[model samples]
Target: MSDDRRTTVPVWTLATADVKAPGLPAGESMTGERLAELRGVLAVMADEPIVTLEAHPLPDRIDRGRGIPLDAASPLAQHLSQFITQSARTSLTAARATASGECLYRMVVPAKVAAQLGQGTVRSMVSKAGAGGVLSPLVGPSGKIAAHASYVPVGRAAAVGTVGGAGATAGAAAAGGTALTVAAPLVLMAVAVGVSAYADQQRRQAIEHITELLEQLQEDKLDDERSALNGCRAAIDKATAILLDQGRLGVSLGLDSAVHTIDTALSKVEIRLGRWRSALDGIPEDAAVELATLTKAFPGIDDQGGAFRVHLELAALAVALKRRVVVLQAVEHAQSDPGNPFENFTRQLKRDQQWLDELELGVAAVLVRLSAVKLARPSGLRPVFTPSEVDRLMNAAHRIHQLGVGVTVDGRPTDVAIEIARDKDGSVTVFPALPA
Candidate 1:
């Protein structure tokens, strides 16, 4: 609102008509990238370089008026609006943040600055080595902030402007930089020496701790999860055994009892695992990070091992259950449909039910893991995941692969093109969005 009243101090919009941003969110319409493109176009048309606001006190929220895209709407429209509004509010807060004593500040300069710099129309703000701050750009009557202006903290205005003037060229920079290069190697050498001295000591301590934990897991609590996992495997074995056994109804009843017994054991394991869910959350970020290198590589995805582990266990159970369906279908298909056809049909019905149950459980597990991955983790910490986490995901991925499901979308633009749904025939339908 304060920005609205300043007729002489108007902020520029991105000012591009055909801004091409596929795969970018609508809320990012006035983002710095788009703004830069705007400045380039404006400069080409106006026959002069655009200007940036060098003399910024703080930008209270820049109130770019809002309107929806001409072609589309999405389920996240409300959320997108909320985020854009929040960004405006946040920018405003950042603009005036110094007054509030907020220590951290970020300033996104207007796009015009880039256009000027790209075209060599203006010189950049220079900084003297060891200077405390930077200089602000000068404002001109042309309604542009300054030709070669830059964003600097309100505190750094003096140091940056005076640091290196027109006389300081790349040649001068070379003459002044030997100390920094030498200093960096020396610092690195010292760090290496320190790490070498401490590396063995840390290793010994960790080895001792891990040894103790292994002993405990093997003895005291004995992680019934080991048993649970075994039980799940045993259940699959029993289910497969009975279905494959060349036994009549009377003979198979004993095998069916074994299946029920295995199921009970697996259920106990599931309940036991539920108690350990919180411990997964307690896994140190450092530890989870170490483990993530083994799972997958993606960006901005959170350390999901905590939730993903549970999903893995459930997925394993579902997979084990699903394997029984394959055996059932094989056995039922082996039987002739004409002779005792009703009995054969009943077997098929039972197999279908088992398949559906497994499919539902598996899908739910995958979705849960997907949700976990969606949570906030330290961004770009490392691309590699830890071996254990990777092993877990690989196992889950293997099950999903066996199921052979994938994301799909269909529909006209006038109808819902992207929707998430599950079909009874054991496939997931995902209607993903595409740029218009």
Candidate 2:
């Protein structure tokens, strides 16, 4: 079995047999089924080497009720004793008295292991014990499945060779067995609460990280592309809504499933955001300015500038849309898992398709300028291609390819040097290209 299906709690405190009724028979025989059930419980409790067991009398000193003293040698007690003897020991803390009149013999067991118990056992055990079962942390409030108290009702056992035992003998023989039972449903509820709290914490941390990344991009000045800015804003809103909605809907019932959902969602968003950051880092403000300069200075370049600018605009837009796609994809996967409530989804897939179109067009334009086309200007009229023009277009194509778009630049590439000067009117002028 997988670790998740194995067990959760590793330690237990076996407590019970607080006060037997006075004047009862010296011994009572348990049903074979009940004996087997108890044995199965003991076997699981002692299955792990790291598990610690502490045996203590429930309600150590009864202050008010008139009851017989515990036998301390009953079948239940013997099973626990033998199990403890065989299992590795851990340092146990001091034992204290339980609530008065509480008759449940409590045994802390693992959740997954506890889940394996039959409903009949859970029901009968609780009905027999006179107390309630509840799950409490093995350590602090760590929202991890640790220890759960399970109560099993047991009757007094008869002493050997005591045919007409006295009241004292009966009381002595019945000392170890108690008729305490606690409700198991309450423990189930407590376990749910702990798991939910842990999932909530994990979700919150991921949300904070995604929000931080979005906010950083929001603060940047991408004035040239207002549409891209607006798209980014929309994406942020969508991502925030996605996470918040998941939180409101609540985590899945199983701890492992809930944790896996949270982790997968977090991973998808982080990966998408990581890719966006990388794409943005490659295109600096100077690259944008160089593209703008090329548009004004290169002949016939301004005609194609609209397409080039749109490509850059889409690149910015993609930085946000890709993240939104990841968010939607993650949410879609969660909702499709037969548990989540998110039913309707309209994914933002158009962004990726549009990005591919823009990247292809931009790269083709750069390659055309580099390999196929030559300047058409007459003598003394200045050449059409400048070093800065080649450098700017080549760099832009490289950036596009780095963003996961394929681009082809065939043949031996030559470097061209071109000086740029700013006129008094704040216009950029490119000088003649130097020899390659």
Candidate 3:
């Protein structure tokens, strides 16, 4: 798909039990059908690993108020037990659940991976994972799926297990064989650990990708600005060439000030571009947290990655303004005695003036947007452009404004006005105005 047309997918956190409940509930059992469905989902998501977290009830504690603990030696119970460390099991259980009664499983999917899967598929996966099952009807038909702008992992695990092996172990555990009970937890742990590692790798890759995108955007913007500056220089040269060609007539009109103002503005823009490049170079490599901040702050970063294209446009308008002033001067110099002296030149001057007015407004709007741009910084968010850079841009805009004001038909003949007429054929004609 084209970059502009691509869909955005958010990082999602999925839960197999009621996420809003006061205490974690003993999650629904992963039946054969559910297991098969989940494996299918995982198979589709093989490109990206999903992190899983299991919170199970304590073996020793049983609270009737919350729910009953599962049989300690049950396959599910044994799988939960593996997560409990000898040193912190009690504290972890007490903090995570009520009376240590229920088990809760959570899976976190990164944005890239989630992009490949549909919401219906996710709902089905969650449902099969045991949300809204017979044992937990209150949880609702669909699993809890929370979207995040950033990836957040539950915890890290160590070990790796194949997809086929993990499924087989889960199936074996569900079938209730004593021999398989001992092996199930080990296989599940390996799968959990492998997924955690995979998720970590994905996170690192995401951070790198975001960093590269940001840097490339800055580079592209700078290149465009440089091109715009070159365009301005070319427009200024054209205007200068016109004045030189007009010889004494141009000199008499006193248009040197307008040219100088535009030249100064071009210089300021050039300096700002240099500073912008340096600032972009100074930016450090992004960490995961900073990447999250940038992603949230600049969700449409790609869309914003280009020159404003206003500088060159304004420069063109300035050139047109100078041209109009020269034409007015030439008409006066000729001392023409036409019925409607210099009518076409006056009409063209009006059009150029209107264009200049519109371009000035555009520059003002660009300044407003530039003032609002903020980038991620170590000390917190800061304006992307430095105060000096912004001032330079403003100065350039002011010069463009001044060029419009400086070049004008201050001494043009009053009778140089034009008249417009429209025919039935829908064509319009311009002619020198008759008296009154």
Each prediction's whole-model lDDT (CA) = 0.28, 0.29, 0.30
Model 3 CA lDDT for position 181: 15
lDDT, candidate 2, residue 369?
38
lDDT of 1 at 46: 38
Task: Residues 203-249, candidate 2: write the lDDT tens digits.
Answer: 23333443444344442333333332333333333333443233322
Model 2 spans > 4 angstroms off: 1-224, 227-231, 234-241, 244-314, 319-323, 326-330, 339-372, 376-436
Q: What lDDT, from 0 to 1, does candidate 2 have? A: 0.29
Clashes of each: 23, 13, 2
What's the lDDT for candidate 1?
A: 0.28
Give per-residue lDDT, candidate 2, residue 4.
32
TM-scores of the models, in the order given: 0.24, 0.22, 0.19
Residues forming the 10-long window of minimal summed lDDT in candidate 2: 118-127
Order of all candidates by lDDT, from best down to worst?
3, 2, 1
User: Cα lDDT for residue 135, model 3?
Assistant: 19
- For candidate 1, the C-alpha RMSD (Å) to the true structure equals 30.1
Candidate 3 segments whose C-alpha is farther than 4 A from its true place: 1-221, 228-239, 242-344, 369-436
Candidate 1 lowest-lDDT run of ten: 177-186
